[model samples]
Target: MGPEAPRHAYFVPGRIEVLGKHTDYAGGRTMVAVAERGFCLAASPRQDRRIRVCDAACGDTVEFNLDPELVPRAGHWSNYPMTVARRVARNFPGIERGADIALASDLPPAAGMSSSSAMMVATWLALAEVNALEDRPEFRENIMDLTDLAGYLGTVENGQTFGSLVGDRGVGTFGGSEDHTAILNARPGHVSQYSYCPVRFERLLPVPSGYTFAIGSSGVAAEKTGSAMEKYNRASRLLSKITELWREATGCDDRYLAAALASGPEAVGRLTQIVQHARPGEMDPKALLTRLEHFLTENEQILPAAGDALARGDLARFGELVDRSQLASEQLLGNQVPETVYLALSARSAGAVAASAFGAGFGGSVWALIEAAAADAFLDKWIQAYREQFPEQARAAVFFTTAAGPAAFRVT
Candidate 1:
């Protein structure tokens, strides 16, 4: 960590899930963008295989050996950086050096703007730079492009194997690549649309001119730990169960629910029948059906239509579609809390063009689209509205405006 040590620095932005909710893991589509705020990190290589990370803001530091058997401290912020180090070591062996990383962030922790994923990405980028992981045969063979890197990083967080690279313990979430994809690939001033389970790019639509997004953090931490982790993973597990049942009922080998539904024209009807006739103790038929409905309506319908609406400058239609997404998240995905629900409704009433609670959503934040000229007034009104309703949260809530920001990159 001295001036003479070779160093690399990076900035990894947080992300907003514009349209897709709990759909990424199911091989579904989502519109996402990067937030202006994120993590800033500087890393220098260590001669020995010992990784040490210091939180510049808090002065909290964690040091660990670059070993595959590294166990993360439960409920500690270091788990994110530790998981990234362990995964890198496991995936690309023969690494003789580690890194000394110091990081600072402006993004709120656990407000569902992907603070955790951003940290993970920053950690990986630092390690990759110091150890030249990208030039390694293992890394070159596995990660072909930014999209592939995003997908692989997602596996690092979810404990899923990416191609020939193996996976071990993740940070205890069964999420997908949406956050990682946006963090790595979002275009400034435009919303990027993508589909996961293989990470495909669909299109990019400009944010309607004269408008910006107003983000309101609900002050309820949506950390993917403890009970919240169970709830978040349950949504993912339900989708997996649906795919399993679909394959069982019909002899298809579709890997995801989206693929299962796309296998035939009668797929929906057949899946509905399978759910209805499912035996006791197999899975909750009602939850499975509701989850499927949300996925179909959100991914197959609302997301694409919303993108088209934005493309055509149809603000009214776009707002309506976002409303549907919010309702579905509340009723079907069952991720929304009262605070988030209130934020979405209140944002609309406060005259946002479109609004919805976004991210892993047991309790998180909401994004409201409004004219740039009205942003200041809109935030004031929106914050006032939230304050009147949830006074306790008003002190913890954060309100800010940002245009779609740049992706993660080297800080030069």
Candidate 2:
């Protein structure tokens, strides 16, 4: 690749998990919107099997061979693109060419805005563009649509096999398709609801007129790596353990916690009993029960009602439901930090209709819904409150307002 070479440009936006916290992977539903901020990439094909990526913002470059056996450079940002390259190489064979990609992003990294997932989606798009992977038989057979592609990409991140695509070491997070779904399938000016474990679109509700989301990054890096990875995965693992118990007790092979609970009206009570009576193993029974409680309330009660509130223009009711979701994240999921908690509470105090910390929330950002006219003042007051409370975090904290944005696409 040279300066004179023609390049394909693409943009992948970050996302806001507006209502569903830690519910996607459990085969549950979530409402999400795309952020105005995201990653932009210019990629050109290479004649050889070497993929080179340069981060324009950070001035970091990583080059690796496009091989299925490629091992990710642990803790390095390159692990994201490298994982995509490895998975693409394995899933679609006879890909002799690679790419020279230069990327830049306005989205904050590790701030729970799906920056990492956006990077992966961008890399996958670049590779797919240069190689025409979508034309491949395997790709066509497995990924029939964007929804299917999102599900497959989720597996790519979590090291799970999708259809006939074999599994490999992922970026080391046991997560789901929510981020990918929103990135690939989001509609502008609307928050979309989706269910995972074979991603399906439920419906889309237009964001109320004159309302926009103000995001306050808590200045806490919520990178799904290191100790934070364990905390994030713990929530996911609890769902898995509960599903395991459900299968054992009922003699059913439902793959996800959501599926088991949806089995019957009495499924919830039965699962709760199962969790309460489980023999101790990898997870404490008490922790399992809390996870169950959160999932039930969030997936069954709060998400649908919130969506309905927004549908009917019931902003007050919507705010109250969002508040319940936030409390569940704090009390039941145990993923909220002092910074995030304060951000949510203070945003409400600052006149946001509703506010909550989102993403894999051991430490991350919060989203506050407010009038478009008041966003600036709300942001000012919210950030001032946050900074006054935690001065050390003020330097890293970022605040912005955005409406729902479009999904990932080629920038022709």
Candidate 3:
């Protein structure tokens, strides 16, 4: 790679979960909007089959030979870009040469804004360009669809292991495709509605005029691995466990939680009845009941009505749903900490139309829907309120207003 060689630049947007909280991995539905902040990458083709990746934000650099033997570097951020490069090499064997890639971003890492996914997408897209994969008939015929690409990346991030090979699962988060969808499919002025079980996009609901999306960081990092792994994995597994209980009790063994939810209130009522009357089981009955409550509230009401409210410009209703979603996150999901809860509540008090903590939630960022006209005042008051509580943390905390943005795309 040299300065004279042409470098292709790419932009991949970060995402904010607006309506759905901790529901994607349960094979449930969630609405997500693309944040204006995202990852940017510049790549120049190399003469050798070795990829060099530089993280501009943290000044970390990793260089790896594009080989089939690459395994995940557990607990390392560079593994993400490495995985992207490995996936490209594995899927497109003809791409012998790699690229010199440099990354930069305004998006804050560990804020539940999908900063990690943005980098992965950026690296993949850059490799796509550097290898000229689209020019190959096989590449154009198969790997060109944006949704499919997003799904593949999502699997790489959270998919389970397959024998000795570490298939797609990166870093061990076990998350679904919501973040990738928001990064790859979100359109400007619209939010994407879709389900994770079947991985289909329902529709794009428009963002109403005179409103803006505000994101407030909790000053606490939402680190998904190490200490948080058990809790995050437990939340996902509990959903499956309850669904299993429903199937066994009702003799309807072939149903997902989302499908049962679609069957309406009576269906859920039956499950609740069974749960309440059941004898002491291996799983904590109370904990199972709490999770069931969160799952039903989102799949039954908050998720379905959110699209309609946005379509009809009913932001107030949407705002109320956001608050409910947060409450569920706190009470049932147990993902919120004191810092995040206060930020959300304070933002609402400062006149945000709706406020809730979004993303993987063990203390990440919260989103607030505020009037476009009052955005500045809202930020000022929100910051003041947050800083008053923890002045030292205020330095690392980030606050900003964003709107829907287009998915990852080439930018010359």
Candidate 4:
């Protein structure tokens, strides 16, 4: 057993993307808010070099010898903590400690709520505490700030971080770090507007008075391992090809869709004209134009316009933008699944002021901005309708109100 040590608990919130879903991987911007629900862990150091992990929710426990060479095992939830620990050991020299960790969560995995990212964040925090990384001068010398650490952990999962457990460098999906940012840096009652090309936080937009956010799960899991991985990779490839095409025609090397947008509406207008006449033979005949339309519209119109509406407390206008973004997700981005589309539409019809399918889409959940006073009634009606439509799925679906919460914290 490891040496006896003091115990501490940690919590890391999950994140919901309000707009600009797949755009993050292509260097576009996104709006993300931390959810109240997330993963929680209680950990203590042990004298032995063995590590034990317990998942109270799943009634599963795993034990392993602490080693820098630990690798992820398929279908095993223990891989999350093991991978984080291995990364810390591999990256930080002179760290030869292990801990017993107990994990639990109300966050639904694969619900587009970033449950996996939350787990990664919590695991890192626990390891830091047990290793005394904060107090050790050597470990603290080049220590990462919360935001940087978040992005680092994200890269670790995507198989981009140096010394990641998975040999391929990613679990499968090629995604960006918006989830990490929201999980580690979001403030309560506000949403973060960030640019991914350079990964910087631009601004914080507060929730207007009298309004709150609610998430309704479609009950279809957003698995990134199977065919979903192919679809996600395809979207990213299309975005890259579009950027290359734009550079070839306009002589702009900015690569980011946001850059083209920054050149003003006239630039976007002219680019669209060029694309129309540019010989569809070289482009992804069906997706290129639609993807460009969605990307340009999001950067040039929806995001900024929605930011203004929310800042000015114009919930009605903000709601309109939400609906429009959902349309783009379905028609242009092609990420929406039938259940998610139905949930967003049903929320609106059930009196939600504005509703959109949030997160990566193709499954997961939809978030609705609605009057606080009417939240309960809206949730009840929406869930009931969803159950009637998807009876078998109703057992797995989740619906509830949530407020923005702190990204993460140590309880003791």
Give candidate 1's TM-score.
0.99
Model 1 sits at a Cα RMSD from the real structure of 0.9
Write down the TM-score for model 4.
Answer: 0.87
1-412: candidate 3 lDDT, tens digit per residue: 4769998998889998888887777778888889888888889988888889888778888889887667758677877887777666666676787889988889777888988888887877887787787786655554456676666677667754322224544657767778888888889988889787546788888888888889998778887778877788788777777888888887875446777666665887788887777667667778889988988788668888877887888878888878888888888889988889999899999998888888888878988988889899999999999999878767789999998778888898
lDDT of each: 0.92, 0.93, 0.80, 0.78
Residues 1-412 of candidate 4: C-alpha lDDT, one tens digit per residue: 2345678888888898888778777778889898899888889887766778888787698887666677766445666667766666666656767788888999777899988777877877877777777776534443346655555666666656422322234455677778888888899999889877447788899987787889998889886666776787777777777667678887888666667657665877776765666666645545677888888777657988998898888888988998999998888888998899999999999998888887766789999887889889989999999999889877899998998778788888
Q: What tens-digit string does per-residue lDDT give for candidate 2 at 321-363?
A: 9999999988998999999999999999999999999999978
Which of candidates 2 and 3 is the stronger one according to lDDT? 2
All candidates' TM-scores?
0.99, 0.99, 0.90, 0.87
lDDT of 1 by residue, 287-333 (tens): 88888899988998999999999999899999999999999999988
**What's the candidate order when arranged by decreasing lDDT?**
2, 1, 3, 4
Report residue 404 deviation for candidate 1 (angstroms).
Answer: 0.2
Q: Which wins on TM-score, candidate 2 or candidate 4?
A: 2
Q: Note each model's CA RMSD in angstroms.
A: 0.9, 0.8, 3.0, 3.5
Which ranges in model 2 have alpha carbons more than 4 Å from their true place? none
Candidates 3 and 4 compared by TM-score, better number: 3
